[model samples]
Target: MIGAYTIGKKAVTFGYKRYGIPGAVASGGAALAGYLIVRRALKRSTNADATGVESAIDAGEVKSAVEERGLGAVTESETLERAIDEEDVGSALDMNDVQSAAESETDAMTEGSEGDSSDER
Candidate 1:
């Protein structure tokens, strides 16, 4: 009976050891596949960033050239036309006037409230 039990245990151990090899291979394959995918994605992102920086430098150079040539030197249909568009300084001053008027009215209301409370006392 003892000998039979020992043989049964050995058979089970051998079965597990055989299957373990395939399990290890599958794990290693998955890890390697993930590494390759991530490496490819990083390379593509780096290339896109380099291209964007180059384009920005070109845009800055064009703007600088327009400024140096004076507004009259710029042709009528160029991008410089949009850059030199007039801003309404008068309307900005009107906004400040409106804001000050609002603040003065609020101060008056607070003073009126205090005067009424004093009269009641």
Candidate 2:
């Protein structure tokens, strides 16, 4: 157990010497070269090798759909809309017809209730 502890401590010290502390203060160029060589040997965690900058933007890791930053006053901005669709127009007409039917039914029920109360009197 004592031997194992000593070996572990030595291994951590070795790692810190090689990479943990940025380039040695004694030599500039050689130290930087050593650091670069060691880094090249290690695996990179970025997708830079597989995708280009355009792909990165298209992937949209940074979202853009948030409400715009503005003052407290509410203001409306005209947004670009798609050309009017036939299906949308048809659905709107159908919705208006259904609304009219519902209103007429409600009015008839109200009149019927009033007539019943007068008859009871």
lDDT of each: 0.32, 0.26
Clash statistics: count for each candidate: 0, 0
Show pairs that collide, candidate 1: none
Worst-scoring 10-residue span by lDDT in model 1:
83-92
* TM-score quality measure for candidate 1: 0.24
Compose the digit string of candidate 2's lDDT tens values, residues 1-121: 1122333344345446766643222222222222222112111212222222122121110111111221110111111011111232222222233233333443454477689999999
Candidate 1 regions with alpha-carbon error over 4 angstroms: 1-19, 48-121
Error of 2 at 43 (Å): 67
